[model samples]
Structure formats: structure tokens, C-alpha cells
Target: MGESDPFIQRVQDVMNAPPLMVEEKESIQHTAEKMVDQQASSIVVVNEKQRLHGIITEKDLVQRVIAADKKTGTAADIMSASPYTISRRAYYYEAMSSFLMNGIKHLPVVNEDSTSQVVGMITLSDLLKKQNRGKFDVLREIEASSSESLADVKFAIYEVLGHLIDDGIPILHIMKVVTNLYDRLIRHCTELALEEVKEEIGSPPCDFAFFLMGSGGRHEQFMMTDQDHFLVYEEPAKEEDRQTNDAYFKKLGEQIVYWLETAGYKRCDGNMMASAPGWRGTIDHWEDRIRTWGLRATNENILLGQNFLAFRWIYGSEKVRDQFVRGVSRQLGKSKIFLRRAAELEKNVPVPVLDHPIRALFRVKKEGMDIKKQALFPFHHSLQILSAEHGILGETPEEMIEHLKEKRVLDEPFADELLYAYEVVLHIRVTQSWDRYKLEEENSSEVSFRQMKSRDKEALIQALKAIRSLQTKAVATFGMA
Candidate 1:
């Protein structure tokens, strides 16, 4: 399950090539026959240039032709247009992501050089056939789950994570794969909550967006994660309508939290969840709150704003989410005082000093450090402050660093150094957390330096140094030096 493993291999390595295809003008009868002859579940639709036009699957055939009772039609008439596709160069995880996100089973593979040239076709079955059952079983289970059975799916995730770790998969890739599963789990919970809410109260009164903040928002969760979410509904034209909308959303939020908790995510101790009043509001209310956070710049206000600044929309109206995000960026752009205060606070937080093993041997007991607080936080907090100041709305620290690099706000070499340091720190944190989970210990971020391999200890020390440098740079950038 290492890099050379087929599970991590390129799509071209596993995709079924010489894909069954039918010309656009081919009769529907002929298309069905081709599928039957090839024993294919799906066939690609192509035009004169051997380029992909669309795709036809058994579902399409049954629903579009058979169910419609159509006597005759061309492939072009019934084919699903602009179907999703993947590149031959993509990894298996990419295909898995596409399938999971789009809820598509068959993915036509295209040539990297010629984007439309059908190189192969991959199906969910293809992936399932190649990888270990444990890896994909969670996805199927999550998708099929509709009840409290979803609670079991959360435990299944750790098993999958263990397998990935054993396979020597990169921590970052593991993060993406696990994040997708969690996203699906959260989305499924949201759906169930919505259904219950609909049954209890009719349809929603207005458009709204449910979003995640903190680590979940940044797609950085590795082991257990707590709830850090909010809701933003469209402003009602009338006061009465506003109250109605608020009541409906309040119930909806509570139900969502209930389902997520059932699925094993703990409630945020800080109460940064949709179930809380302050976390769910109209766009106007949210905008005003954002302005207040900047205008006030109190310690608590800055912390609250910092959490919200990492928000990523999970469900509901993208239009609403975009509007809210735009409002946040606009407010942040004008909040120089808030940014400066945030930087100053971040600068004042002490990073843990990793003592050399030789220097620590004389101590009565070895010291354990919270890698998250000491290393990861400095990297993320610094980037977060910088990103907010520059109006760069990248959700994750990596994205923020790249955005800053693009804007020339951070020099290329320095940004690269910061990214590498962040990765090293994150790798250590996730692995340590995973190890603790396996021992059935309480979820803790503490990493014992004495237990780490010499190389790891050295790597962590270097990462912490880089983080400190970034903190210094952030303070200077905000004129707090």
C-alpha cells in the first residue's frame, strides 16, 4: 500500500481501456447491443473525431429508452451530455473522490494530452475490485446509511485510517481521503436532519447555508473531530418572516447537531455550532457581527472571528455562502486593527522549545508536548492572520500559503519552507494521534519526545523553528514588530 502500490497508482494503470463506445448517430438499439456484446455496464458516446461526446449507461438505457417506451432513437438523443470524466494521469484516490462527490459509478478516462480523447473507462466496481474491501466498504456503508447505523460508520473510519497508515500512504493523501468520508457522513446527517425538519415543519422558509469552521473547515481532521459549524439563512423581507425563518433553522440546526453527534463528532466546547444562536443568523446579522469583531478587537472577539474566518460551506445555497464570504473578506480588508491585534496575540503565544535528547537525558522524566498547540497552531495562526489581512479567503493553511506566494506577499522560497515545515508538523501530529487512538487512549494531541525516533525529533525541532520564524514575520508584516 506504499507509493508503488496499485491502490495509489495512476488511473491509466488500472482503467479498462479500448472502452466500449458507440458513435453519436448510432441507433439506440445498436448501443444496447454493443453494451450486451461487450458485457459493459456503460458505453462512451463519441463524435466523428473519436472524441468523447457523452456517455450511455444501463440506467440511462432503462430510464431514457426502455421506461420511456421509445421505439427508436439515436445514441445522441438519449445520451447524458457532458458527463463527468477523469484524466488517465489521475491517481486512484482522485477517481474515488470524483465518484464519491458526484455520486457517479462510471468515469470515462481521457488522455492527458488530448483531454477529450477517451483513453479508458473506470467504474466504482473497478476501484472496488482493485483495492482492499475495508478501504471502500466505508464509502458504500456511508452512502447506504439512513439511520443511527451511521454511528457505526464513524468507527469504520479509524479502521480505514489504520489500513492507510500501514500501507505507508502519505499523511496528506490520507487526510483528503478521510476528509471526503467525513464530508459524506456530515452531508448524510444533514440530509436526514433536513428530512426530519421537513416532516416536523414544512419546507424551509428561506435559502440558507450550513458551513464548517476550524480544522473541519480546512479539511485537516485526521482522527476524531468536534463540531464547529454555523448556519446563515437569507434575510427575510418582513420581521415576522425573519422570526419564522429563525425558528425553522433553529430546529434544523439542533437536529443536525444531534445526527452528527450520533455519528461520533463531539460538540464543540466553545459552542461554535449551528445549534447555537450566535452561530446561526441572517446575512445582515453575520455581516454586522463580522464588523463588530473588527471594530471591537477584544481578545474573545478576535478568537471568535478567527474561528469563523476559517469557515467552509458544507451544504445549502452557494449563493448565500458566497455572499457571506464576500462580506467577511470585505470586512477583514478594512480591519487593520483587528489583524494587528490578532498578530500580536499570536506572537505572544510561546512555541514549545524541543530540547535535544542529550540535554534531556539527565531529567527525571521525559517531557511530552502538544504538537498541535506548539507547532501546527503557530503555522496555521500566522497564515490565518496574513490571509485575513490580505483578503485571501483560502480555507486551509496550505491554500493560504500558496495564495500569499501568488500575491507576492510571501517570497517563493519562504513560502515553500513554511509549507514543508507545516507538512512535517502535521504528519507527526496525525501519526501520534493515530497511535494513541490504537491504544484506546483518550484523544490527545500530546507527543512524547523521548518516544519519537531521532529523525522525527530532529524534524519536529526544525519545524518549530520555521513556525517561530513565520510568527516573527507575521508580526512585522502587520507592523506589530
Candidate 2:
């Protein structure tokens, strides 16, 4: 592509057309000088062949070196390694999507011919400036405000979503942006809770991990659904210490829940919030609970394990989360009967459509088709069972698919097909949920077949078939068929 290419206003047109190069071994001071000389916000570290090594941004320098009072280090010492990169041929929207998905400011534009060759750099700020200002402004407002302003920002989000839908952006992409925003909102609430707790009780008595379960855990959540979370903390050494720690963490968890509810997040109906005593516990207690659940092999236990295992840490210590994951995996792996019982749970999810086209068209729409209960559940539930049996806890559906494929638990074309089907179903749910929001109704997977376009109906029917196929494989693999 030449400088005067027709797509002059595109990302390809402006992305480091000449390329800014820096050696990985160069001193931070030297890199700083180069950035200043070029009037650039970021400097790309590259080797002799122009292969990208990492990137050093102004934020990285301020946070890692300057804020930490470190005066000496190579660019490699502070640069963000294995940074997100885009091809020079990619469009500006693709670059913007990457920025939102990865939560990164700067991205290196690489050569299309050779992926490793860095050609230019782009920032989210630059891309946003070039794009339409309306939706981007909503994102900016949400990011800049905290709980005090979340309600107003949410109003803006609704407007943004309507605009995006009207513009015909894909449902999956819209959900991705919405999910990212929710993650940020959760973090902001957590921060506020932490500060309040600190003021009440000098400091945390011990390390703890706060995590979300269910859709939020899987990174698939779109709307402001009910929240499900739990807490895991290090076991205290003495009786008095244990009591002190419990009191502090319990109060902290309550504060978080309260703040989240205040910010419009509905509390979990199952009482799975960290504020609940059952969901807040020492690491040893959590391990014991998992061991008991595995031994019981009961329906409720399996359901509980299903929700708990699909968790993502939001705050506090990583070690606590890691230890809990290993413990749950070990306990579940030791029980063969538990795996089979869990796999059998898929039989409970009713198949809402048939493979035969005419029969599918005649499919009943009682309370509409629950995309979650009837479509996504079979796949998510079955995968959760397989993951538990294989001791593969804490993986998203996509990650689980890859792991299962690698283990020969599922084969090629089938795996790809299933992943695609999963994406389609998720997209349908988001679109349906958006429709509900537009009607000022509750968001749910239950969208009427009558409401869908002919193509959407076809896609939904195909998704049902895919779920059925996976359910068959799941039961057979676990000796439940």
C-alpha cells in the first residue's frame, strides 16, 4: 500500500507508515529521547530483522520506572512484552475492536507479509478521534466515572447500544464491548469497597480472592444480570486470628455487594454472593466443601460444582484462586461416579428444535425459546462435566473446546463446528436481549421464534442441532449414554 492509497483515512493509511524502531537493549532514557524526537506516544522495540520484541509506552514508563523510582533499566525491563498487534492491511474498526477487547492503549501495526515485522503503531485515543464521536463518547464517560455516576453512564450505554444495533454492528461485537464495560464497572465497585473496608479495619487481616461465577465468569455476560460471586482467603493461624479475619472479610464482602446493588447490579437469587457466609470462607473450608460435593455425587452438588468451577478472579490474591482450583479439580477427578452423574445432567436440558427443517419450523415457542436454558445450557453444562472429569477447572467454553480437542476428547471438524455454533448462539442471545431492553422488558434467552427473521430462525435451529450433537458426544464419553 502506498502513502497516497485511496483508503488514506483508514488505519492502514496512518499506522506507522514509516515504522518507529527501537532496540530492546536500548536504555529507558534513550527510548524516552526517541519518543520525544518523533513526537510519538509509544516506541516499538524491534530486533535486527525488524521483528517486534515489545512496546514501551508513556504509561509504562511513568508507572514502572518513574512511579517506582527506578532510574536505570533497558527498554526490555519495562516494556509490555507480547503486546497485541494488528496487520497493516486491517481496517480502522478492527484496530478499535482490538483496543476495546484487550484494554490496551497502544498497538503495533505489523507487516502483512511477515507477522513479526513491526511497521507502525496506533493508539486507542487516535482511533477514537477518527471514528464517529457518539458511541465513543459514551465509552469515555463510562470509563472516566465511578459508582456515583454509573446510573447516568448506563443511560448513555442504552443510547449507544441502540445506535450500534441501528448501525447493524454484529451482536457478538456489541456484547464484547458491553461485557468489557461491565468488567470495568465491577472493578470500580471493588476498589470503592476495598477503601471503605480499609477505613473501618486498619488493613486486611489476610490475603483473599474475589471471583465471579456463571456468565460473568465466562466473559459472556451482556446485560446487568444478577451477580454470582464468592471469596477465598488464606486460613488464619489461630482461633482468634481466624475470627478476626472472618469478621473483616465478611464486612468487606457485604460492602461490595451493597455497592454493586446500589449501582444497579441485581443480587444473585441463589445467594451465591461473597456476602453470604456459605460463599465466603477460608481456603481449607473451600477444599473440604469441594471434596464433600465430589463424594456426594448428588444433583444439587453437581449443579453447585458446575457454577463454582466456571469462575474468574476479579480481585485480591491469585494464589488463593489457584489453590482453590487445584483442590476442586483433584477432588472431582478422584470420583468416577461423580463425573458420570454430572454428565447425565445434560439429559435434563430439553431439546427445543429438531434436525428436520419442517419440524424445526413447527417448533413450539412456549414462553419463547430460551436460548440459555434450551440452547447454550446443554453445551455449557456438558463441557463443564467434561472439564471437571479431566480436572480442567476455570476454563471458558472456547478454551475448554481447545483442551478437549488437544486431548482427543473431540476431533477437528467437529470441534470447529461446535465452537462456531457456540458463537452463533451467544450472538442470538445478545440480539434477543437487546430487543428485550428496547421494549423495556427484562433481558432473557427466551426470544420468540416469531420475532426472529427467517435467517435468524434458521441459525437458531442449527444451533440447537449442534448442542444436541455435543450432548450425544458428552454422554457417550462419560458412560452416561
Candidate 3:
């Protein structure tokens, strides 16, 4: 690869080496003089042992020293402590993502071996100058998007997805990167909605957390994502205070849904959005609902409970989110009957397309099979129940599978087979989804048997068979057989 190839270039190739460094006790005036003398925008502040302690940027000098008139302050007092740093050997795209996701301009580079040792630094300007701006324009657009401009950012996201796929990046890696972009977009929408809500009503009554569900929750979204989110707020002490908090969160949830729709995300067809009464509630209410779902374990309740099991906190108070999660886990731990029922329900699900021989392609028909429902759902449902039983929580199926293996629930060979099968199915689903998205199709998970390459079709069939075997194993393990 040439020097201009951005994909293959490492961070060391672009960073400023022998970065200007100053001791933590150095005066602010001296740090400023070093920055000016070096003609650098930022300087790394190190301890006496020459380990990274903090970073002092020109902005720090201007705002912390000159504007505040703290002329006698040392570098340690003015610098940003424990600033984000990148490995010298990381790919350039990783550095770009760090810059885009964190909204930071200057990223300190540390030695790959001893992470605390400062090695170099890379600025956002350096990235823009070194790589093609068109590739990163979507990230910049997302950062700068308004309510009206977010729709355009959605399209730019598709472009980036296509580029990543063409560049031969692993499907899971691409999903993570794309998920980060979507998370940022959701956060932006949430901020906008909060501003509107605060202006309409006073500030929030208490701390709250907004979390995602379904694909967004699992960090598995690739294209055509819908709103599957909920809100949990701190319980109030008095009746009147509770009423006020309810009203405040109700309006906030409605505004969040509205802004997300404006940004091109569709509303949940199952009414799983935060705007719904069942979805948004006080922490106590959520706990009650979880207990109720476990006790009842009706078909509808089980479906809802299963979806809730994958909840991932995206915004707000971590303490509140942790409280909710821990409560649910405790409830699930005692609900052995509910977990068995969930496994039993999944046992009845059949991989219809895989039930017949590949030569009997007529079974798939011209319309194609819904790969997500027929292939992926069984794997997800089985693993979800198993994980919940073991008190393991993860954001993705791969993570859950790894956790299961760690707990000795799955042997090494079986876990490896399941992981490979999952990857094959997921890769096809994502790529086909992108193809359908480009054609403006509504359904993203359907795969036409006729259009699939012979090898992919065979691999998918094998994957589905493996999923079926797992489903059977789940039933036997749960004593449902």
C-alpha cells in the first residue's frame, strides 16, 4: 500500500513524534512558552517519572490562565487530567472514530507497550489533511446536524456503510462503528428534545435514564432501525411530587419520539417507544412491571419481558440504570418457571427453509425467506434465556455467547460452531439489508434464495441447522422436552 492509503495506515505514520512534554509541576506560563516555541497546539503533561499525567492545550492557557487570571497555576492545575489517548499501532480509522465519537480535537498518543508513556499526538486537522474528507464527511455532518439536517445525515450514513463493506472490514466491526454513529445521532436527538422540553416545562423533577431496546440495545443494528427505547426516572417522595414528575417525563418522552422520527427513525410498530405509558415509568414502576411479567409469563408478557432483557442504557444517570438492571436481574434469578416457559416457547419455533433440502428451493418461493425471523431469532431467544438464568448481561449475541462459554454452559467446540454460524448469518443479513435499503425496500431481513450465491446459500443452510441444534439443546437442558 502507498503512503496515501488511509485504510492501511497506522496512527504512528501520521502522529507528531517526540511530542512536546512538560512536567506536571511546570508553570502555566512555561507550558505556554513551550507550546509557542514548538509551534504546537497542545503539550503533554507528564509526572516526574515521565508517564502521561494530563494534557494542556492552547485553549487551556487562554481560558484557564489568561481569562481566569490564574497566572500562578501549575500545568497540573490547568491541564485536562486523564485525557483520551490512542495506541501508536491502531489503524487510522480508529483514531478518526475516537475524534468523531468523543468530539475531541487533540488526541494524545501513548506507547503501545507501556500505555502510560507518552509517544506522540494526532490532531483532527492532521486526519482531515491525510485522508479523504469524503469518507469522514458523514461523521462531521452528524456532529453538526440540526433537526432538519439529520435526515440528510441518514443518507450519508448509508454511503459510509457501503464504503466500509467495499473496504472488506469485518461485519461485526462495521456494525460496532455504525452503531456508534447511530448512538451519537440518538444522543443528539435526545439533547434537542430535552432543550424543547425544558423550555416548555421547567427542569426535570429528578434524575432519569433513557435506554434502547431490541436491535439498538444489542448494538446489532445495521440499517432501517426503529425506535425501541424506554425511560426510567427516580421515584418521588410525595404524591404531588410523583404527579409532577410523571407529567414532566410524559412530555419529555413524547418530544424525544417526535425528534427521533424527524431524524428519519420510524416509530416502533409494537409501541415499544418511550412515549408509551408501558415503556416509560418511575424506577419503582419498572420494577413492579418486571415482577408482574415474571409472575404472569403469558405469551404477551413473556415477549415483552424477553425484549426488556436486552435493555441497554444510552443516556442519563448510570446509577438509576444500574438500579433498574440489578432489580430485573434479581427478579429473573428467582423466576425459574418463567425462564423455562421462555425456552419452551423458543422450542416450538422452526427453521422452515432449512427443514427441506437445498435442491427443494421451491419452498423459499420468489419472495424469499425472512432470515432474521427464521434463522437469527432462535439463536437469540435461546441465548437470552440462558444468559438471564446465569445472571449474565451483554449488549450483543457474541458477547453473551462468550459469557456462556466462560461459565461452562457451552463447551469450546460448540461455542466456536455457534459463533461461526452467527457470523455467517449476520453478515448475509446485514449486507442484504443494505442492498434492499439502497433499493428503497421496506423489509431488510428477507433473503431471496435464487439471488444468493451457491456457497452462501449452503453456508446459510448449515448455519440454520446449527441454530436448530442449539434450539433442541436448549429445550433438553431446560427439561422442556
lDDT of the structure predicted as candidate 2: 0.76
The reply for model 2, stretches above 4 Å from the true place, is 1-19, 23-120, 132-134, 237-240, 348-350, 359-368, 442-444
List clashing residue pairs in candidate 3. none
* Per-candidate TM-score against the hidden true structure: 0.88, 0.79, 0.87
Give lDDT per model, in order.
Answer: 0.83, 0.76, 0.83
Q: On a 0 to 100 scale, what is the lDDT of residue 353 in model 1? A: 56
Between prediction 1 and prediction 2, the one with superior lDDT is 1
Per-residue lDDT for 168-268 in model 3, tens only?
Answer: 77777777777777887888889888999989887888999999988888878776478899999998978779888998999999999998998889999
Model 1 lDDT tens row, 252-306 = 9999999999888899899999999999999988878888888899999988877
Sorted on TM-score, highest at the top, how do the candidates line up? Answer: 1, 3, 2
Point out the higher-scoring one by TM-score: 1 or 3.
1
lDDT of 1 at 421: 86
Model 3, residue 26: distance off in Å is 4.0
In model 2, the clashing pairs are 16-120
Stretches off by above 4 angstroms in model 3 are 1-20, 27-40, 48-52, 58-73, 82-104, 109-120, 352-368, 442-444
Question: Which candidate has the highest TM-score of all?
Answer: 1
